[model samples]
Target: MKRTFRLSFYVICLLIGAFVVSWLIFMPNGQERGAWRAETGGVVLELTPLKATMFSETAHSCHTVIAFPAHMKLVEMLEGATVGMNGAQLELAIDGTLNTQRFDRLDALPENCTAPDPASASARDVFDAAWTAMDEHYAFFDLHGVDWAARRALAPAPDARMDDAQLEDMLLAMTAGLDDGHVHFGSDTRGYRSPAERPGWIPEGSNLNRDMLRQIAIANAGATITKSQTAPIFYGLREDGIGYIMLREMDVDVPIGGRSMDAMATAFANVLADLDAAKALIIDIRYNPGGSDTVSFGLAGHFIEAPLPVFTKTTRIGTTQTAPFTAILEPQGDAPDPRPVILMTSKLTGSAAEILTLAMREIPQVTTLGEPTSGGLSDVMGFTLPNGWGLGLSNQTYLTMNGDLFEKIGVPPDVPVPFETAPFLDGKDPVLNAAIAEASKYLQ
Candidate 1:
């Protein structure tokens, strides 16, 4: 029976290797031999002897990079194309399959093709450039219910008579119409930031200080606090044996007292030692806005025993092409104890903070409490308009492991706790109280 089992295992390994090799050999590497469709439509953004880049706003809000074949006819067709012209497209037969792409609008031709002087360009020039740029680069118009074409049509024509201030107002209004929190337009003298209603435990501008929170936790929960010098991690053990940790932010740089060391990692290791000894832990992330996701994954390592798949993301490659990928949070070191943990969240918990919340939820022992997270998970990309104004927009979409898109929609908690400023101001944290109560049951 031992020999039979070994033989079966060897056979399975061989089959797996064969499957991998076949996949590598047969997979489309984006370069397939096919006949070129000469007459296609798009706005030529860049053209060179070896490659061509074009933008198609009507079909997909992205630029397509195409490698030129050695065919003279294809090269001539590309050379004949003019940048900022709407009439261009590509039809290619790859691996015996035909695919066609079309781009309808051109915002601005390449700088080499037609550079507009920012100081003298008409308001119409700036408006058209901004509109075209959004049409090509802004990825979430459909998701956010933005009618780009209608917005463009409604825009007042850029008059040469308009001053810089007037042009700025028009452009800012155009961006504000999108209603995306990530979308913003800024120049030297003025700026416009889109507003979002975030659900946080602490009210905005309430000034419920972090130091006060530490005092409240220590006094109310009978906890001993250990503050880290390298990172904003305040942790301690409660008298009831439940561990408490509050992470303020992820991106903190501190001196290591003349030693070449990773401060965040060292701080996390020390906190994990204290947490491992406790029967349970309460992680507070209410005030955290966001930072690097790597820090969140490092914290997740203390509870998860193996690599955990947290979320999936897709980036727009072309007008109709999106490349999807999964992000996995790998365990960093050995977790000595996988005890129950209660995570506290708020509306201020966003970006990497929200990602950490999701990662913690993958652990069976973790129970999340408080209001839902601030839904701003998508990745932001920046574009510069003709007038040197910068625009930031969400270009990538993130989804949960179960394939749920939570962009602009927060991740709800397992236990809902409404935020009340009065109770917190009085030094009575109802959320933390409930968490302690819940943890006591797990400890017992």
Candidate 2:
């Protein structure tokens, strides 16, 4: 029985050898030498060069047989003499090294390739793809969308062989394709500032456009016709013996009662004292981007005698956190008067401003009016790569006081009013007219 098994194994081996030789003889010339393969988090990329290369001829007798693990696009691997693969964090490591970087065939795969991995696409990838698509498919690339050629022209010549710092600048320009809010390079907290403070990190002539200004204006257009400034407190007044407050941002110049709240509680007290019927109040938080929710709740306490859930946050891991809120009418005064109150909002309102809107909904005396808010309400966290490129990812979901989701969608106001055009064009807001009208009716 052993002798018969040995003979059968030899026969099988002989047949496999014959088949391999026959397949190799009929295969196209040099098909085996130019093959490349890679794996990016289980997604495989495979490439085969059609022609013979000097490196392939020297590596093996077949003159064109190279094996690669399939993880990325085949064309991208073939275009390079050296290939680097990034892991889940975009940490780079060499995947394959080649003898030469030249490809000499018309049908050969082109340089600069990408694979279609949905989950692997980072925020930077999304920005890069959006730009490259418009650059290639737009009818007049130079004249339309963000200027791709102009941004790239700022880069040194390809053969210039740039250092890490120079290369970082080129990458920054390349990633600025969408030119949208919350997407920036170098640093995460590079706040929008006056033109005189433009950093040297970015190339020249890259100024904000009308679209960018529109985004900022809409977000800042809270519930009143108050003056616009980057400062936290803009204008405050006592209207009809009622407390009226206009705040652009959450940061305060001084702590409120030494509690370290970002809201100007002292200023709020001073304004409240000036009002006779200060029982009712108006808070214009339409353009407020957001700040410490602690301040939001501290302000909320003035309205509610008892604590109420202002908002809740659910992390990506499913843990829930609830914050309580109330508002104070006056410092060292009685509890917030439950009299009729008006809170203003607009499409430019977002983040903590949205939370404040929802929290007010819990109070029977408060009425919110205006338009839908700017829907940039996702809970995002900043991440910086080893290469110094910054990114923001939406990892957690936010819910309003009433268990309402605020991701991508913003708070909807009780009353919707369209802003008049001419005033808006001249940078004079007309939304305040609508809010004042609504508040006046309730106050009367």
TM-score of each: 0.65, 0.48
Displacement of the residue 8 alpha carbon in candidate 2, Å: 99
Give me the candidate number with maximum TM-score.
1
Give the Cα error of residue 316 in candidate 1, in Å. 2.4
Stretches of candidate 1 exceeding 4 Å from the true structure: 1-126, 160-172, 177-179, 187-190, 197-222, 254-265, 425-427
Residues 1-444, candidate 2: write the lDDT tens digits: 999999999999999998666545433334323323211110112233322222111000111112343322332333322333222211122211101122222233223222234344343443443333223322222221566566634544424544445544555656443322233334343422112112122235543333433343444434233332323544434444445566565544432123323234444444455444554566777656665443454455566766564555443321322232222222222656555667777655655566567667677778877666554443333323322334432333456655676443457777777544455445555566565566667555
For every candidate structure, what is the RMSD over all alpha carbons to the true structure, in angstroms?
14.9, 22.1
C-alpha lDDT of all candidate models, in order: 0.62, 0.44
Shift of residue 66 alpha carbon in model 2, Å: 46
- Model 1 TM-score? 0.65
The superposed Cα distance between candidate 2 and the true structure at residue 258, in angstroms, equals 4.6
